[model samples]
Target: MNTPELGWFKSSYSSAQGDDCVEVAVTEQSVHVRDSKDVTRRPFTMDLNGWAQFVTSLGSN
Candidate 1:
């Protein structure tokens, strides 16, 4: 996928030191995720519904 075209952004909680940075970009049907430090790697993609469910699950932990 053309990750750069998607305008990925890191979490607001991300620090300037750049550790543990998770970058994400929202598209109409899917959400793209990648490690900010090694963006050249292929990203993980999930459907919107799955992304929502995953986020909800994280909140429960």
Candidate 2:
């Protein structure tokens, strides 16, 4: 998707502190993720199921 089509959401953990973090967006077809520190950088995309697993893993970390 193009930059304008993305609806980014910064992780609450990232916003709580000023440190470097990542942002994530759940798109219609896939999940879009990017560095919270750099909006212009390329983002990583993953399928819905992959995103779910990734989040599940994060909770365990």
Candidate 3:
């Protein structure tokens, strides 16, 4: 994926000190996720429906 063109943003739950930072970018068809601390790492992508289910599951915990 062309990550540089995506508007990536850090998770709201990210620490101020930059530890455990996760960044995400959303597009029409997929959701991109990556470690904010290491941009060189390849991000994982999931379909929008799958992403929605994953987020919903998080809220249940």
Candidate 4:
């Protein structure tokens, strides 16, 4: 399925470090992420709930 267009934002956690990171945009249907350096590439996306779980899991690291 084609991803809906979104205005992705970079993670605040990585802001101080500069642009070598991924940016994200979350909508009601899914969360989209793409390499900041390569906006033209296909982004990775997951269902909202699944993305939430993934974010939660990241905090444990």
Q: Give me candidate 1's TM-score against the actual structure.
A: 0.87
Per-residue C-alpha lDDT of model 4 across residues 1-61, encoded as one tens digit per residue = 2344687788777867667888888888988988876777889979989998998999999
* Model 1 agreement with the true structure over 1-61: per-residue lDDT tens digits: 4467897888889998877899999999999999987888889999999999999999999
Clashing pairs in 4: none
| Candidates' C-alpha lDDT | 0.89, 0.79, 0.88, 0.81
* Candidate 2 minimal-lDDT segment of 10 residues: 10-19
Candidate 3's residue-wise lDDT over 1-61, tens digit each?
Answer: 3479898988677778876788899999999999876888889999999999999999999
Residue 11 Cα positional deviation in candidate 1, in Å, after optimal superposition:
0.8
Of 3 and 4, which scores higher on TM-score? 3
Segments of candidate 1 deviating more than 4 angstroms: none
Give the least accurate 10-residue stretch of model 4, judged by summed lDDT.
Answer: 1-10
The TM-score between candidate 3 and the true structure equals 0.82
Q: How many clashes (backbone N, Cα, C below 3 Å) per candidate?
A: 0, 0, 0, 0
What's the TM for model 4? 0.76
Which scores better on TM-score, 2 or 4? 4
The lDDT, on a scale of 0 to 1, for candidate 4 is: 0.81
